[model samples]
Target: MSGSEALDQGPLRVLSFGCRLNTSESVAMRDLARRGGHAEALLVNTCAVTAEAERQARKAIRRAARDNPGTPILVTGCAAQLRPAEWAALPGVSRVIGNADKLTPEAWNAAAPPAPVSDVMAARQAAAHLVTEFAGRARAFLQVQQGCDHRCTFCVIPFGRGPSRSVPLGAVVEQARAAVAAGYREVVLTGVDIASFGPDLPGRPSLGQAVRRLLALVPELPRLRLSSLDPAAIDEELWRLLAEEPRLMPHLHLSLQHGDDLMLKRMKRRHSRAGALAAAARARTLRPGIALGADLIAGFPTETEAHFAAMLDFVTEAGLHFLHVFPYSERPGTPAARMPQLPVPLRRERAARLRAAGTAAAEHFYQTRLEQARQGQKETVLMEAPDRGHTEHFAPLRLVRGEARHGAVLQARVLGADARGLLAEVA
Candidate 1:
């Protein structure tokens, strides 16, 4: 059958919700369905990071059913893990699978599922599996691990996703090669804890080794990036690999929930603000001019004035380029939700303060870049202008008064900042 005819035979309309890891899994699953010639109607890959996440997942499934009224619904992901009963009972949901075995076809067809999906794992929590062998896309991700071993008091992930898991390095490399061959320009190594990849295997190759092996396998790819990693997961070797690999994107999105030590402890996080700073420092030293992004939870239970002040101070001093601020939300079955809850008024106040701070912090970062460019520091930019590219710094420069080839990094002379990006002249 022709490829188009094959797709028509059994079309699985895939949808996804949740974190990057889940999104990656959905893409992998969709590819499998397409290749296998079996289609699903609105195969909803739902997410449930927070309670709102669960609500949204339901909304997504219902919307899918509304859009494709006659299609079947497949519900899965974190939302499925912690709330299988709710999902399975949805109007059009045909099957609901938890993190345990949702990625595989057989596991997806399991007759029975857990209600809350609290406590259970299909394979060894660390069993290395790659489900995207025949997947095609402009870019693809390899889910190297699943579940979190860390039972942070504020998190329901442990109860839902089980323990830390890792995929085998060989399977990961092979899948990456296949994806690259399928015309994917980039391959992102992703997971619930990709930093924990290779642990399921006896050899326990470091995250760096797994990435380097994949790069070696697909040396022709234009880009290779990583999903977020726990700040505590890196080491000297990882830093070294990052420094040397030009193909690796110059971005390190660290998980820094709060800047105060007390708040971090309250959240049951493994790393301290100091620890996060130290890692950022090391990464900066290894790769100068790298963009460092971070996650910040503005308000948490029991956070005090002193704690918030400390956090604000740390953020200003950290020289972080960008921040993703989230106000604390209580998720069911997590310890933090039941802890002495912060007043809604207080949470709103802190969120406002943090939002203002984020603006100032970002402005300072942008102004700093302007100053550096003024100092005659020219950087190579990669042109992303479909017809153009920008520098390594990602300063969007116009093709401007000259013919520039697509995807070539050329020295750009910064004109000045505008509502657009770094307006520049091709040097």
Candidate 2:
């Protein structure tokens, strides 16, 4: 083929998988590819948050190889971090770069070791790990930090991601500008620990400082969102900025792994249920009615019935918008993994109860919003369901008829709570 023919081939499609933290690294990878004069490489960013996610990621790899034959594949992110060896053995994978290489300055060099492909079928079936980045979404995330220092016994992330490290602030600001110019309405500031955004950096300008710098870079961008944050990471300045910034999403996702103090201590997590409660209260005081969500591990080792009740009470009183609940899964390496295991039956019971609590909390928060909507509170819902787009808040406002456009902020009048969100008809 001629040089012109190769040049017109296409941009490299790179995909990353996992939470927002991985998204930042993947964005860095895309930048590296673009600057090196190979802007045509279409980077396919993929995700693998669960076993299903892993399976789907592998599926994407195979699909990519088939659709674009001879493409040099780069497998990366948490899946890479956790199972680099497994990916290295897969067919169609030109490079099996893991957590280490994904973040390296040269993410898409395509000049690395090739896989052996000894057992092509085995490699193909192996799962894709969690990737931090998301591609083709309206928003992009800048992962400022990686690795969770928290030793939550139910979590395998600390093991998979290793020690926490912050990306240089200057680089982050530059990345944010590029993303904004690319037409992403929003950029999610993400990381394994976003609150620890600049702790490893000299002077640690703080997560708030980093975000303020980002806004300063692309003030025109309509919105920016911060991913999960530990209550311990919150400070007065952070909430104050959130209260003042219109571009920043009024969404604070606090990680409340468990509501019981003793269970939290046993998990080696930093915050107590009381501490989490205080943090939520602080956030509400600053941004009243701001959407606050959280995560909860339903059952930890040594969690008694009383402990579960305490967790339920805490969540109920705290008024969380929603929660992502999980039955504690003991990974191969972790302190809780060695403790006297809870029977599968009990784990199921505890998880179900916590789920109920989560639903009640979500409903209560939703109802509060509904009441406000009834009283003529203006809700700028991203009209999606009845043929349009939706909100980053992720609340479903049942399919309603109107001129609902993707990205169009609708002035909705709340009818009542329907199957969707605060059931509102477009006004």
Candidate 3:
């Protein structure tokens, strides 16, 4: 979960939750609110990825109401999209807007209808918002697409978001160019399912084609990165770019979900255990030592000890450098929720085990990088702060002997490793 404020003293305050998409949308909402003259509004953009996420959003809303008396709190995003009346009924909530209307200018108008949440499934086309500035970050997230078409049994995102819709190629390039103009060193192409990016477009371009074009058009853009991707849906053009494009960052975060084939089937995921390994192997082969990250779920319905063990082993086999582990949260109305459920304690335990494995793998990878740095290898670091930043591989780097301006990209050499991350010196 990520949170941000429009301005320290600005009249409108925005609290965003969930994925990068939500963060990008929050920034847009803040801009809309300011433009619409909603000076006393407090916007809470919520998420429904898991039950805990919704709980946290509710908690934040209550806290906001308690802390700022009489503020008109407008709730939006996935949680509100799914349950408008329920969220609108909450104390201090002035209105509940759906995902469909949240980004539109009309939704922010003071004279708009109350609780305006339309059926998300009815949405087909997704328009690109020219969001160049990301409130307080070095990297700008450019949403190239919207929603998800696949219905993974353990997921509720599709219902919260809408069908997979691509923001036209021209719009994507325009946004990337704008981000570069705004002095953003890095721009991450984010979406609900980016791998499924282009069939809806006129020419039916792939994600890789869009990327290649963006890099070409916006040659000054230093680095380009992608948000979480679906491993099973990677196209040939994307693979080619991975092997050739220097501007395209090497770090890839895959939405693997689960490692066991049986569990994947139960979860309605497209990739198998072997398919995931192949994806990782292909990535490393194309971009040697490229950092690999995965989103894995532990204790899915009917997952046995053997299944769990296989998943643990898969982590080591795939050489995953980062992991986003989640304990299975049974969402109501999902197919998995209707299946045989795993004990909540067991699910949490398995999640911990997966996280530990990921930690060990990441430490080992960092140590390897540290060794290379000792050998006098240099890395391009994008400083997110005066003394901290990340490498092309997305390794957290902390400068111990030098300082650089935020958003400055420069070469640096790693000096050592700490519990936090890599310690480095500007070269």
Q: What is the C-alpha RMSD of each candidate to the true structure, in Å?
A: 5.7, 7.9, 1.5
Best by TM-score: 3
Query: Candidate 1: lDDT of 49?
Result: 57
- Report the C-alpha displacement of residue 249, candidate 3, in angstroms: 0.5
Candidate 2 ranges with C-alpha deviation above 4 Å = 1-74, 86-95, 103-112, 115-136, 382-394
Model 3, 22-95: lDDT tens per residue? 87888888888777678877888898887888888898889888998899998999989888899998889988
Better of 1 and 3 by TM-score: 3
Higher-ranked by lDDT: 1 or 3: 3
The window of 10 residues in a row where model 1 has the poorest summed lDDT is 1-10
Model 3 alpha-carbon miss at residue 22, Å: 0.9
| Cα lDDT computed for each candidate against the true fold | 0.67, 0.64, 0.88
Question: How well does model 2 score by local distance difference test?
Answer: 0.64
Candidate 3: list runs displaced more than 4 Å: 1-9, 130-132
After the best TM-score superposition of candidate 2, give how far the Cα of residue 158 lies from its true spot, in angstroms. Answer: 2.7
Q: What is the lDDT of residue 378 in candidate 1?
A: 70
Question: Candidate 3's C-alpha lDDT?
Answer: 0.88
Ten residues in a row with the worst lDDT in model 2? 1-10
lDDT of 2 by residue, 270-332 (tens): 888778888888778877777788888766788889988988888867877777777776665
TM-score of each: 0.81, 0.77, 0.97
